[model samples]
Target: MRKRERENPCGVCGHYHKYEEGEVCETCGHRMLATSEKASVHFSAFPSEILPQFLYLGSYDNASRSELLKTQGISRVLNTVPACQNLYKNSFTYHCLQDDKSLSFDDANQFLENCERDKARVLVHCMSGKSRSPAIVIAYLMKSKGWRLERSHQWVKERRPSIDLAEGTLVH
Candidate 1:
């Protein structure tokens, strides 16, 4: 088992604790949700591997799960959403995009390219894994693998069928 986090965030009250799964959170006095409970779809429960071991895609919920990230050997996080908190900064390296309105793929893909070059396991995530984050991953594929947009989009969708790229994000 991974050692308990010395400053884990309590889901209910936002207080930090020395935390482990199934243990009681100090501030909220509520029992932590066990691992089985994290499988809910609403939780962005599992990460979709985009490049075998090197690249992964998930949601803010998955990004928040230190245990899950650790299990996957993910060492870096590319947070596509400005609003989602980088919850495990002490455990992972994070690159957060600043713009919420229209993110350019160039900057985002640069981060993805760097992680790939270093062979670091990285997760790219937004509020939900469905849209923003997947778009980012697709962009990375297009750039890194020299794939066209449609082909790249299809590739990620096949791996993570939950993806739903917003109409605004698609090119004609």
Candidate 2:
């Protein structure tokens, strides 16, 4: 319980209290701790900028927020998690791929390439933004920029700092 408290301190009151699932903060009567725990653990303090002025990579939670997407000038979303809801379907051009390891990258790469050609900013996201999405971005770098898999992966890692590409997903 102490470990849980340490990991999930209340954002509002700054209290280190263990909260039961759905429990409100006792000290300040805030629900910060409860809500914080439900957010995507894959999120980083800073998401990766895969391509300057064109592509961003982030988690499902980040992709669902229309205001954040608008603020970043993201005109399209390439969601790698098929089951995840498209919260801003009408507002942004969307492309969804099922989160499967065997999924092909040809279409996704084409979509991203189109975005680049049109000068549109696109956000690529999966459930966690750690695996599927980054892999897609890496493939794009390889195809469009003519980079090898290792160099593309390294470049993404340097920018995002928390990307974890799944095993066997690296394409040359």
Query: How many steric overlaps does candidate 1 have?
Result: 0
lDDT of each: 0.79, 0.75
Root-mean-square deviation per candidate: 7.9, 8.6
TM-score of 2: 0.72
For candidate 2, give the lDDT.
0.75
- Highest TM-score against the true fold, candidate: 1
All candidates: TM-score: 0.74, 0.72
